[model samples]
Target: MKPLSIITLDQISDALDSIDLLGEMRSAFIAYSSGRSVIPPVGELIIDEQPPGEVHIKYGYVRGGAHYVVKIASGFPRNQELGLPPGNGMMILFDVSNGSISSILLDEGQLTDVRTAAAGALASSVLGVPGARVGIIGTGVQARLQAVHHASALDRDDLMVWGRNLGKCSLLASDLEAHGLKVEIAESAEELAERCRTIVTCTASHTPLLTRPMIQPGTHVTAVGSDTPDKQELDPRILGSADLVVVDSLSQGLVRGEVARSIDAGTITPGRVVELGQILDGSNPGRSDPNHCTVADLTGVAVQDLFIAEAVARSLV
Candidate 1:
């Protein structure tokens, strides 16, 4: 029997630096949408205690892949108050040939954060305008990753950011500036949306932050929050008014995310939603008109976890 390999957070982060994270994420989405991967629906546990938290169980396997992965990640909004990080979790990797546990990736949710940010960047590159200034909503860890990943992917340094708390927004802007991005702190979500053509929302808000009136023509919105049925970031009407609406997974989108909320509100129909994989695979025309307002609601799929875990594991080897 082969000994199990235990990987730490630092090792995982270092491995990711050398990996083509965006390309891996792009492939994950394509495989999932093309029916080349087996990803079960996400299992979630919502904590209603003070300073609420949520735990997500996401796992999957790619057809003909050497390993299967099960990832457990969590988010607690007020963890900073307790002098701890907001996100934490790990991934378990198993060998497919012998059904043996091959490795334990103690990433503590860093993999999830990076993979999600990579997905956001992928969405921006495919749907957004070239050289457009990016707007980021929310000042959480995901917000910082989204800004950094989008900057790297789009090859743009200018960013506008908005958050409910001004102090956190300032901190995030300073942190982004250290990464060589010229960051602008917006006074409000509306102000941020008004200034940038490409917007990424990575908040934990249960209410709508970007409304229909705030979005301009030729704008592309990539929303990575609202992974649960109750969490929402965009006004459903904004999706209804979008010329193109894309999701990471049609099955996940119809049950959660902005698409589900919009459908519940009778603003958008499921038939109108296109999978990002379809666009990547060239089966669907995405953003036929540059002036079209596009929105991508990503609820975070398990295949993403599988791909990132596999990539990190391979890099370590």
Candidate 2:
């Protein structure tokens, strides 16, 4: 047994910057959706302590690939009150050829942040129409990353931000403004929805925040907050009104994602849910018409971790 390549968070971030996250994630989504990748159901642990958070255990492998990944990610929203980051995680790589432990990436969820934002970019590029302004909900790392990524992907200079905390919302606007985007602040999530054609929700709220009537025609909603059974950021009625609803993984989303709640409430159907890989692989048209309301529920997938780990591992010495 040789030594494990203990990679640091900075190293992983640098690696992430070097690759095209959307491209890599597109391939992974295609493979996983097309049955070319194997991913089991995610394991979740919820701690009901003071902070109140959840940890996710995910593992998956690309068929015939050299390496696989197992990721343990956690999100504690109240950690900000303790002057710490809300999300943290690590990834372990394994060599399929020898069944040996390959490397350990202590990214502390940085890769997750990047890949998730990349997925948002993908969703925006595919499901949203041209001439649409981007609106963001939640003033967290994901809101910043997604705005930066989506601004570049959509080639737009305008966006809007909404959050319960006025300070954080202003901070996000300033940050994105420095990135060359004309960022505005919305009084509420509903106002944000009405003002922009594309809305990205990234909060950890346990209740619905964005409702149906607030969303207009031709709007695209990217729901990234509902990764577990207890979390929901979009109202179920919104899914019912959407012309098209896409998810990263049908299996995962149907069980523990926002889509699950929508399904349970009889607002949506399995037949209406389309996997993103279908659009990535050109099997299904992403947005049939420019006026269609599209909602993408990305609960995060194990294949995403496998893809990112493989990319980072290849870049390591």
Off by over 4 Å in 1: none
User: TM-score winner among the candidates?
Assistant: 1
Off by over 4 Å in 2: 1-3
Task: Identify the leading candidate in terms of lDDT.
Answer: 1
State every prediction's TM-score relative to the real structure: 0.98, 0.96
Model 1 Cα lDDT, one tens digit per residue, 1-317: 58899999889878988999889988999999999888888999989998899999988888898888899999987998999999999999998788899999999899999999999999999999888899999898999999999999999989999999999999999999998899989989989888999999999889999999999999999999899998899999999999999999999999999999999999999999999999998998898887899999999999999889989888988
Q: Cα lDDT of model 1 overall?
A: 0.93
lDDT values for all models: 0.93, 0.89
User: What range of 10 consecutive residues in model 2 has the weakest lDDT sum?
Assistant: 1-10
Task: TM-score for candidate 2, please give it.
Answer: 0.96
Error of 2 at 225 (Å): 0.7
Residue-by-residue lDDT tens digits, candidate 2, 202-299: 88788998988899999999989788887899999999989999999999988977899999999999889999999989999889888899999999
- Which residue pairs in model 1 clash with each other? none
